[model samples]
Target: MAINSGSDPMRFSASIKVVLKDGVLDPQGETIGRALKDLGFESIVSASSGRIFRLDIDAETEAQARKIAGEAASKLLANPVIERYEVEMAK
Candidate 1:
């Protein structure tokens, strides 16, 4: 496969947040919430577990960088079945 290195390359950073889709059971999150409650943090309502990925890519524009990062998240970082991912550009 050929790589596209734009003539005017700018480094961009992206953050990918992978989380369980709503209505999906998260055993780890439940455990954490319970633990927090047991630790005397009674005000805690709920907790959920998720994964974050930080990636840096060379692109010509912010849109291109976001597309690359989003593709990576969809194809490898996140499972489409029970999980969803959100991509954001880092400042």
Candidate 2:
């Protein structure tokens, strides 16, 4: 849970992006990249895949919302062993 300094939080938006860790194998991304090349897309040399989750949150403040969203990202949105996550908040 996020530590709140006050009550009656405002609504905010949160986004969680989950991507494969560095040095990890991403079969889906690799296959997509190959397909792009086979389709005469030479400019697409490095194509990677990731997951994005957009959520609406209510918290006491932006900081609290960020903290809560980050915790959710780590625990539910991403796999700690093979994937990394980043959480962002929107107005």
Steric collisions counted per model = 0, 0
lDDT of each: 0.95, 0.89
Best by lDDT: 1
TM per candidate comes to 0.91, 0.88
- What global local distance difference test value does model 1 have? 0.95
Q: Kindly list the per-residue Cα lDDT of model 1 for residues 30-74, writing each as its tens digit.
A: 999999999999999999999999999998899999999999999
The residue-level lDDT of candidate 1 at 43 comes to: 97
What TM-score quantifies how close candidate 2 is to the native fold?
0.88
- lDDT (Cα, 0-100) at 71 in candidate 1: 94
Which run of 10 residues does model 2 get worst, by summed lDDT?
Answer: 1-10
* lDDT tens digits by residue: candidate 2, 49-85: 9999987888877998899899888888899999999
